[model samples]
Target: MTLWLSSGLIFTFAAIALILYKWWDMQCIGVTPVRTLVFIAILFTSGLDVGLIMFPLTEFGGYGNVSDNPEYGFANPLAIEFGFWAFLIWGFYFLTCFYFAIIEPRVQFFEIPVVKFINNVVIIGTCAFTAYLLLANLPWYLPELSSDDGVVPAFYAIVFLSIALAVYSSSKIKYVRILSVGSSLLFIALIVGMWFRAFVLGQGSPADFFGTASMLGEYFGNLNKF
Candidate 1:
């Protein structure tokens, strides 16, 4: 069990490092200021969700054997806690697509160099993320992902497929013509990141500044609801 946990943790770390490295490269080359902000924002929210999930898991005990005792069981507490985390993490992802793929095209009708650059980054990342599912641990098998908690992934896949179709659509639709392919690629990258951090890491990764804030917000937000 310890070995399994360690392996999962390492997978997450490697995935995150790879992602950050890619983002850093983008930053170094001045890919786009907006793109940088988008990645940073997502990373920050992810950190917080993971931290909140960890606090209870660690405090109760390391993820070991499953038990029925309410005091010892991780399922109930973790489910309740991580559900919100998943909600927020996925909420942002969905909103990103809604704004970028749907709304922006209708409203802006133009892409600046930086915005276009960011769009490319998003596309490439999405492609990589989808590839990871096929080669990595295969998160597609997880039942949880198809359930209520999986709404974000489902929507992500939907948005991604839409982007793919948009790529092949009539060229006169300026936004679709310009961004479809890039959006699809970014969707794949994000999926890969999700697989790495959620399934591989299992929410035990270290905290970052943004992640800390997310954790606090969710923890308190949930508390207030109750």
Candidate 2:
């Protein structure tokens, strides 16, 4: 698994390097050209999901226990968490966007009927899986709303409503842009709110916050190990 992951990382970087070398000054215009901020907002929202927001707290303990999980010993738990969520993982998205924006029009490989059908099927499957993840994790986050078996109608209703809203929003590009930018702003606000709560309202000092954040430097310092 590690070898496979290493190879993927190497390939992603190589592809990114080649793309940059070939089109250093080229602008990527999408089907509908939007401002730089909207483009970034779309990418930011599309590249992440609720799982990322909820994953670290659950995995941090395992990552920190290097004695049991020696594979994670190369870096601190914070570093491991950051490495999982950021850095080279995002390169895959970059490559996909680049391909669709720059290469797909020329090749038209995805325009084939079978390929388009398969692509849409994969997209629908992905969305279903994402919704399932939310449904499965909701009980843990909101135990009060869950039954004894960790399943409840309320959870199902919430997930159904979420999917319904997402489908409705996706019917138009303007709705997608609005939701993407709004969600990005909301995520930023969430981060700031948490930081303020932790350092300002809570007992933790500003220096403590910085000290905790600085632990992420281990990931950068030991990038090759990751």
Candidate 3:
């Protein structure tokens, strides 16, 4: 199988697993489908993106050729994979932020309700700022912060809106609160990975950090050969 296809398979499995986990947990706790579906969607997307990127690199030998012949570790269009993965990472980040801001306090996961509310608000705001750094400008900002030129901005905005709505609608569920915080931490980790990878690649800012972490990169190479 092509590298992109293999990665897609991984993403598919991860998405399914996340959905099932969220549904099962919420069902046991008496949370209805409405509540669980939102969480499932958010997590599934995260897994999907993770699959899209990692599978391509690890399986396909992510790289491209500038000349007629390509060499291993050679730089090519695959560099764009970094940006694509970063975009997905930010998508999850905002989703987590909104969960914390609006959902966590409602769920009563935090002993201090006020603390949960405040933390959620802070996380959401920070996500917004980080997203700007990642999407609007890259090479000028940071390498890992770069994103795919077309879809990144739109996807980020959509995820942000969805999370905001979820937080606003269910501001009083205990389990929601716990999940929100956990999701936020995960999102933060994703961002850190992108940033660190950029630095490793010698990109001064997160802006220049594009590499194969997406199925698209692998496909791009295969297409070139054809």
How many pairs of residues collide in each model?
A: 16, 0, 20
- The window of 10 residues in a row where model 2 has the poorest summed lDDT is 49-58
Candidate 1 global TM-score: 0.28
Q: Sort the predicted structures by TM-score, highest score first.
A: 2, 1, 3
Q: In model 1, how large is the Cα lDDT of residue 118?
A: 87
**lDDT per residue (tens digit) for residues 1-226 in model 1:** 7678566546655655555565434313222333544544444432342343334433333322345344324233444455445554444454454445445766874377887888799877965664443323223334455554434466457546745664565344334323434544565687688667865678544455345446445444453232
Deviation in Å, model 2, residue 145 alpha carbon: 0.7
| CA error at residue 214 for candidate 2, angstroms | 2.4
- What TM-score, to 2 decimals, does candidate 2 have? 0.87
**What are the root-mean-square deviations of the candidates from the true structure over C-alphas?**
16.8, 2.4, 16.2
Which digits, one per residue and each the tens of the lDDT, describe model 2 over residues 135-195?
A: 9888878978988865789999999999999999989889989999999889899899988
Candidate 2: which pairs clash? none
lDDT by residue for model 3 (58-78), tens: 433334443433543333444
Better candidate number, 1 or 3, judged by TM-score: 1
| True-structure lDDT of candidate 1 | 0.48
By lDDT, is 2 or 3 better? 2
lDDT winner between 1 and 3, please give it: 3
Instruction: Please list the residue runs of candidate 3 whose C-alpha ends up more than 4 Å from where it truly belongs after superposition.
Output: 1-30, 34-39, 45-114, 134-226
TM-score of each: 0.28, 0.87, 0.26
The regions of model 1 sitting more than 4 angstroms off are 1-86, 101-103, 106-110, 138-226
